[model samples]
Target: MRLTYSARKRLGATSAGVVLTVIALVMLAPMAWMAFVSTKPDADIFSRTPLSAPEELTGGHYANLFDQFHFGTSITNSLVIAGATVVISLLLGGPAAYGFARYPWRGSGVALAFLIVARMVTPAALVVPMYTIMQNLGLLNSVTGVIVGVSVLNLPFVIWILKPFFEQVPKEVEEAAELDGLTPGWVFFRIVLPLALPGIMTAVLYSFLAGWTDLIFPMTFITDANVMPLTSSLLQMQTGYRIYWGELMAGGIVLTLPPVVLCFALQKYLLRGLRTGY
Candidate 1:
């Protein structure tokens, strides 16, 4: 049987949809299990049915997570570090990305290369140096130390992600703003920034996730239980409570939520920013 062009197109789309559905299911299974197991009893959690949906759901684990584990504090600390990283990263990296995108310099290529080089360097390589530096400055086991250290890890990623978006902005609009007697700084703040807000926010979201999920720097730099971020705090969770599986899943679910919300909220902007800059 011969297929019409319309029939073939429909077939192609159906095949693609099926492929996407499979991929999505593969990605979603673990999260589904995590959410499911969160409602399970401690005994059910360790059984072969780790991914089984609970017959009788309970909020006990979530309550234990908040009350016994003091998850709120670690969450607060995580937010502070991620929040600070987002602001400082945007403040510093945005201008640099814009500069690299807009301003043509003989050395601009070299500088961009250097920034990329920073990304290629392993965080593990710097652990010793960072630890030594923190010790000398007396920042060991400090929140400020974690922020600064994570920023170093995040800045290069921000620069690479944001530079393309910045470059996508039209130079003519900037020139038109200049024609209207708008200073470069004024144009950047009023026009360019507003246009780039989507890319910028998405950049922040990505950078924040990088910092939020990072365990190495936090583990290496912070020793005190009180100052630890949530990722680092996860280590202590299993130690005291005799491994409360439900509570662990609850925290994992909570941990998964923020960046997802952030990405969705800024999605329009991120898409526009990518199109504009790309």
Candidate 2:
């Protein structure tokens, strides 16, 4: 059958819209379920019956999160560690990426290969050696220790991810800046950084997520409840006998928010970073 131009266009748009809607729902289902479960009572969590709503809608879980699990302190610790990890990784990795991007040297390729190998090194492999190092340095059970440890793990990835962006920058810009007598430091901070903002943003977000989602290092290195990150404290929510499902899910939902918000806020530039590393 012959279709009218407008009708065909409309049908195509509708089909695309439906496909995207389904994909979006699939992507978001876990988070939606988590939110739903957070409001549910302990009995409703594992029961066979369907939940139309919470057994009793209340803020009890969040209150319990704050009280019993010491979630407030853990959240604070996690934020501090993740924040420090982002800053440290960016500060250290930025220069390394710039060096790799600009100063290709005798062993630069091999050095980058080694860095990639390090990035692939599992946290499990490093845990024993790191724990020993932390012990010797007396860095165990400290947020600073976790930040430094996580940064060391994350920095190589940051540099590798960011180096391409720096390389993507036009060499003429650097040449012009140099000819204009701008110092290397000034050129990097002013010209290169501004152009490479998107990649830097992506690197920061990934570095933050790396630190935020990590449970292993924190679990192994941290001995004190006061120092446990949200990831480690999240495990505490699953106590054997009395699993307060609402509290557990509430904490999970809360912990999940920051990264989600960050991604949404930077999503446009994130795509650019993905494409051209710019």
Candidate 3:
């Protein structure tokens, strides 16, 4: 017997729910294991079943992160780098994207295409040249070097992400603002930008992640323990022979939390921006 439309809809919904639930479990399983291992004693990490509760738990690994490894320094450095990257990307990308959307001069599409292509290139491929450039500019072994490197790499992506959102803004709104005697600059700052907040938030999150999680530039350009970000610092947990699994897991948790928290806080804007920008 053929199912009614309502019955078919219910069946479809059930299937989607089941699929999504399974996918969520699959994705979350590794994170759960890492968190579990992080809290367990060194001896207990591999002893019982991987997911089983530990006989004892300790916060020593977390303590070691601060006491022995000075993980706090890494956290501070990463925040500075990420914050600077976000500011630079938005200040530069926001206006460029607006220009691209509103004023399509000759060869503008070609220029935008080049920007997207640049973003797609592997960071690994650019490392040698980037390193040489930073060294030439006396930015090596400093947080500023890493910040500059990350900003260069992330700028193209920010432009690409923000362009669509600017395009989505109604030209009519800008014209209306002009009729009310608002200058172009004031119209963008007061009217158009507010409407594009969702896109701006999305761009902010991406720019922040690019800086926070970048390892290549930091590792290549910075050697000072004080200047290293969390991504590069996490590698200190490994030596030639043995890995400090417990402390590594703890550090991983620390590194992961900021981005996750930011995403949760900005989830509404992210969803709205993605929906409307496309």
Question: Highest TM-score: which candidate?
Answer: 3
TM-scores of all candidate predictions against the true structure? 0.88, 0.90, 0.91
Which has the better lDDT: candidate 1, or candidate 3? 3
lDDT of 3 by residue, 123-168 (tens): 8888888788888988898988788778878988888788888888
| Global fold similarity of model 2 (TM-score) | 0.90
Model 2, 198: alpha-carbon shift in Å?
1.8
Cα error of candidate 3 at position 119, Å:
1.1
Q: Model 3, which residues run further than 4 Å from truth?
A: 1-12, 179-181, 271-278
Stretches of model 1 off by over 4 angstroms after superposition: 50-53, 179-182, 240-242, 268-278
* CA lDDT scores, all candidates in order: 0.81, 0.86, 0.87
Per-residue lDDT tens digits of candidate 1, residues 89-128?
A: 8888888888888886998999888887887778889888
Per-residue lDDT of model 2, residues 108-191, tens digit only: 999988987888788888888989999999999998777877898898888878998899899999999999999988899999
User: Cα lDDT for residue 95, model 2?
Assistant: 86
Instruction: State in Å the error of residue 83, model 1.
Output: 0.6
**Judged by lDDT against the true structure, how good is candidate 1?**
0.81
Off by over 4 Å in 2: 2-13, 273-278
